[model samples]
Target: MANTSNKVREFQRKLYLRSKQEPDQAFYSLYDKICRFDILWDAFYLCKANKGAAGVDGVRFEDLNSIETSGKLIKTLRAELVEGRYRPLPVKRVQIPKDNGKTRNLGIPSIRDRIVQMACTLVLSPVFEPHFHCNSYGYRPKRSAQDAVICINGYLKQGYQQVYDADLSKFFDTIPHSRLLDKVRSKVTDRAVLRLIKLFLKAPISEPTAKGKSRIVGNPIGTPQGGVISPLLANIYLNDFCRKIATKTPCKIISYADDFVILSKTPFNSAQQDWIKNELEQEGLKLNEDKTHIVDMTQVGNEFDFLGFTFKYIVGFIQHTNYVKIYPSKKSQKKYKDKLRSIVKHRTSLTLDQLVERVNRVVRGWKNYFGKVGYPRQVFFKMDWFLVARFYRWSRSRSQRRSLYLAQDAWNKLHKAGLVYLQPTKMKTAKVSR
Candidate 1:
C-alpha cells in the first residue's frame, strides 16, 4: 500500500509537468508514480505531457490582437508550435497537427554574404563557373561529353595540360557563426527570431522544452537554406581560394562548389605535379590522392569518368561497360544475354535473337561494335547478370509499355544492322501483337 501511494504521487507530478499548468499537489503525485520504473522513455513521456502547460490566462484573445511585444512572443510561440518544437503543458485532447501555411522568411544579411558574393563574382569568375545538374541522366552524359570535348579544345589552344581532382576537408563545419549571423540580421524579418536576436542578451530563456536541450554544437549539414547567409558564406570561401590561385600562371583551375579539378598543359612530369600540389595546399582544400589519376594525353585515350560523364582524353576511343554481363555465370548467362537482346531490340525496333544462341555470341558481338562505349556497367565475364535485366527495363521506351517484349525484339534487329532490316517482315508485327 505504501509503494502504491508513492507510485500514484510520481505519476501525478509527471502529468502536471506535461499539462504545462502550474504545479499542483495532484500533478506531483502523478509525476512521482511514473519515475519509479527508472526508464528513460518515461522521462520523454513526462516532457511531452509538460509541453501543454504554457498559458496566458489574464490576457484576453482580444488583447493578443495588438501588434506589440506580447503579440510577437505569441507569434514566435505559434511558429515554434508549427515546427514541432513548441509544447503546451499536458492536455487530454489528442489531435492531428495541421500545416498552417506561412511564407518563407530569409534572414538578415551578414558579413559572410558580403564576403562570399564578392569572391564568386570577382575572384573565381575568371576560372571555374557554376555548373547545372541536368534533369535526365540519359541525354545528360552525351551533352557533358560534348562539354569535355570543349575543355580539351581549350587545352590544345592554351598548350599541353595536366588534371588534378580535389575535395574539401570538413568545409561546412569551419564557418564562423557570428559572421554568418551578421548576414542573417539583415535578411531575417521574421517577427519571432528577429525579435529574439534583437533582445537576446536580456531575454529570459524559457525553460528548455526539455532538460539537456541546448543550441546546436556545430554547423548544420544537408539543409537547402540556413538562417539567411549560409550560401553566401560558402561561396565566399570558394571565392577566397579562387582569388589566391588566380595569380598562378600557365594552369587552369575549375571548381563545382568544393569538388575541384586543376588542369595544366605542362607534361605529367614530377615537377609540374609537385607545383600543382603545393598551390592547392596553400588553399584550405585537399586533393584525395588515392582517387586521383594523371591522364596521358599522348596515350590511346584520355577519357575518364568524372562527376558522371565518360570524358575521353580522346572521345571516340574510350568505351563504357553496360549493366548486363554479356557473359555471366553459366546459370544466369542465358537470362543475361536475353535481357541485353531485349534492350537492343527496344532501342531500334529490330530483333537479333536468332543471330545469337549463347551469351558468348552477344558478348563478342557488342564488344566488337561498341567496345568501351557501352553503358555504365560492363557485360563482361562473371559480372552480375540481374543488372543487365534492370538496364533493359530502364532503357525501354515509355510508349512501348503495352508490348515491351515485342518492342525489344524489334529494337535488336535495327541496332545490329544500323538500318530497318527486319528479317521475316510479316512475322515482326505478328510477334508484337502476340
Candidate 2:
C-alpha cells in the first residue's frame, strides 16, 4: 500500500511537471494517466462520498470509505487497472414503477465499478462534450429536458409546420457493444481505459426473478440502463445519428437522451422515417413504434407532448387579429393533478404542516418548470383547487365532520403563512403571430 501511494505521488508529480512544460495543454493528456492511484482514489471517494450505491458485489460505499480497508481497496483497484485484471461485477437489475402502470428496468452497478466508470467519464466527457450537437440535451451539463422542450418550442414559434416525437426502443439495452466501442475508440485512445469500459459493457447482468431467485445472463449488446457511464456512452454513440439527421435534412432534431423530437416545416414522410430507421439499424438501434407520433404544429387543434411540455397551436383573437397561441398542453394539467394526488395519498402520515410543506415543494418545482414554458394561468388555478379539495379530504378523514370552511381556512392559512404558495396567474405567454 505504501509503495502504491508512492507511485501515485510520483505520477501526480510527473503530471504537474508535464503540465508546466506544455503550459497550454490540459492535465493528463493520455487515457492511461487516468489509472493513477490518486485519480482512482479521488474518483472513488467522490462516488462513495456522494452515497453511491453498491452493485451485485454487495460492496457498499461505507465499506470502501473505511479507514481500515480503503488503502487496500485502492491498492487493489490500481493494480487491477494497471494489470488489466479488472472484470466488472454483474449489474443488479431492479424495476422501478412508472406512472402509467408500467415498470422501468434500472441497472445498478457496484460502487467500485461506478468509481472506475466515473474516472473514465471525467477524462472522456470533455473530449466528447464539444462534439455533441447543440440541439442534443441528454446527459450534458447545463442542458436538460426543459431545454429540449424550449428548443422545440422556439422552432414551432418560428413557424415550423410539424413536430415528430420518436424514442428508441430499449435504447441502452440495444446499443451494439462492438459499435459503441468503435465509437469510443474513435475519440479515446487510452488502451487501459478502453479495456475497462469493454469489461463494463460486456459484463453479465443479474436480474431478480419474481420468485426471489437471481438469474445471471450474458448481455451481448447495449449498456446497462442505470450505470453512471451509460448515459454519457449513449450520448456519444447517438451523436453521429443526430449529426446525420441534422446534416441530411432541413428538420431540427432535439434529443433529451433517447427521446427525440424532430421539428420541420413539413410533416415527416414515410421515406424520412425509413431513412431514420435505416440509420438507426446500422448502429443496431430501433425506434419504439408505439411511442412515435407525428403532429402538425401549424394546424389548429394539433398537439404533441415532448419533455413533459404539451405544445398546441391554439387560434386566438388578439386585438381583432387571429393569432396562434403555442401554450402548455392540458395533459400537463392532468399530469400535475395526478402527481399532487399521488403525493397526498402517499404522505397521509405527515402532519398538516408537514404535508403542506411537501405539497408546496412539488407545487413550486412543477410551477417553476411549466411556468418557465408559459403554462396557462388557469392550470395553476386548477392545481390550487385540486390541492384544496385534497386538503379537505385529508382534514375530513382525520377529523369527523370537518367543514369546508375549516379546510378552506386551513388552505388560506397555509398561503398566508407562506407554507404554501400558488403559481402566479399573470405569467407571460409565448404566443406566436400568424
Candidate 3:
C-alpha cells in the first residue's frame, strides 16, 4: 500500500509538471500509444473481463475473449480504422422504470464499441481532467454529486445570499453535433481519430415504439443518450460555456451534468438572466424555464433539493447567524424507507441472518452517503426507529405480535455487528432544525 501510494504521488507530480510545460503533449503521447496493437489488445481484454454488454451488432464479450478470436477482432478493427470505414452499431434503446411511474430511456452500446471508447477515454482523460473547471463536477473522475454540494456549502459560508437554480432543458439531446465537433476539433487534429469520432456520432439509431415497432432514424444532432463517450463529450462541450460564465458573471456556478445552481450575493437582474439564457441559446442549448428560479436562502428557509442533498439556511442560535445545513432530501429519504419497507415486507421469506444482512447493506450505504452532512444524529435516530417499527409492524401484520424489545434487540444486534452503522455525533446546540 505504501509503495502504491508513493507511485501514485509520483505519477501525479509528473503529470502536473508535464501539464504545466506542454498541455497537449502528454495526451498526444498517450493517444499514440493507446492506438498501438499491444495497448489496444490489453484494453480489449480489460473491457471483456469487465463483462461489458454487447451492442446492436450482438457481439458478446465471450466471443471476443479467446486469444485467436481477440487477435482477429483487433486486426479487423484496425483495418476499419485505417480505411475510415468503422461505424458504431446502432445503440440498443431500453426503458428503465422509475419510481414515479415513468420510464427513462437508456442506450446500451456494444462490447466492441465500449472497448474502443474506453481505450480513447483512458488516453484522453489525463489531459482533459486538469482543464475541467473546479465548479463543474459532472462525469469527472474522483468527483461526485456530494463534491458539488460541498462546494456550494463552501460558497454559502462565504456569504452568498441567493442561489439561482438553473436547469438545462434536454441538454444532452439538444447539443448541436456540429458545435460539439467544432469543440472536439479544436483539441484533436488527428484525421483518422476525428473520422472515428464522426462515425460514432452520426451512427444510425433505432428506437422501439410502444406499439412494438422499431423506428430506424438518423441522429444528426445530439449525442446518443447512453453512449460511452456522450458524457465526456458533453463535459468538453460545456467546459467553454462554464468558462465563459465564470469570466463574465459575478455568480458562482456549481454544475453536475445539466443541473446547475448559480450562487450570487444578490438576485440576478433581468439582464443577467437574459445573458445566461442567450449564452446557452448561442450554444444551441435552452434553459428549462419552469425549473429555473432564484432562491433567497435567508428568506425562504425552506430546503431546496440539489443533487440528492437538501440545502437550507438554518438559524444558528448559538452563533446568532444563519448557516447552510445539508441533509438527505425528503425524496431520497422516502426512497430509502420504501426500499427498507419492501425488504421488511418479505422478511418472512428469508432467514434471520439473511434479513439482517439485507438491512445492514441498505443501512450502511445510507449512512455512508448521508452521514457526511451536519447533524445527522437525529436523522440516524429516526431511521433506527423506522426500522424497528417496520419490523414490529411486519410481525404484527402476520399475527405474530413480536415484543417491541425483541424488535429493538434485533436492530441492536445488527447495529452492534457492524452491519448497520451511523456516524457517532452529538446533537446541535439550539438551532432551527429542518
Alpha-carbon RMSD to native, per candidate? 22.7, 7.1, 5.3
Tens-digit per-residue lDDT, 1-434, candidate 3: 01113433354456555655775552333435446565466557656656746667778977765789888888877666556566777877777777669676667777777767766665455556677777888888778877888898888878776788888877777888888877776656655656667777787777898899877688787877777678788888898888887887777888887788888888788998899899999999998898788788877375577887888878778777767778877788788899898888834777545766898889888887788655567767777667766655665556664443444454455555454545443322221111
Model 2 agreement with the true structure over 1-434: per-residue lDDT tens digits: 11224555465456445544653444324556667666777667667655745689898866654676878877787788778787888999888887678888888988878878877775566666766888999887678777787777778778776777887888887888888988877766566667778888988889988899999999888888888889899898999989998999998988987888888887789998888889888888888888887887766777777766667667675554333444456666677788778877634788767777777888888867777655456666767667766766766677767444543455466566455546454222222111
lDDT by candidate, in order shown: 0.36, 0.73, 0.71
> Which regions of candidate 3 deviate over 4 angstroms?
1-20, 23-32, 37-85, 97-102, 213-215, 394-399, 402-418, 423-434
- Model 1, 112-184: lDDT tens per residue? 2211222212211111122122211111213332343345335534654455555554444344444433433
| Candidate 2 clash pair list | 55-110
Q: How many residue pairs clash in each candidate?
A: 81, 1, 2
Q: Is candidate 1 or candidate 3 better by TM-score?
A: 3
For candidate 3, which ten residues in a row score worst on lDDT? 425-434
Clashes of 2: 1
> How does model 1 score by TM-score?
0.35
Name the 10 consecutive residues with the lowest summed lDDT in model 1: 132-141
How close to the true structure is residue 81 of candidate 1, measured as C-alpha lDDT? 31
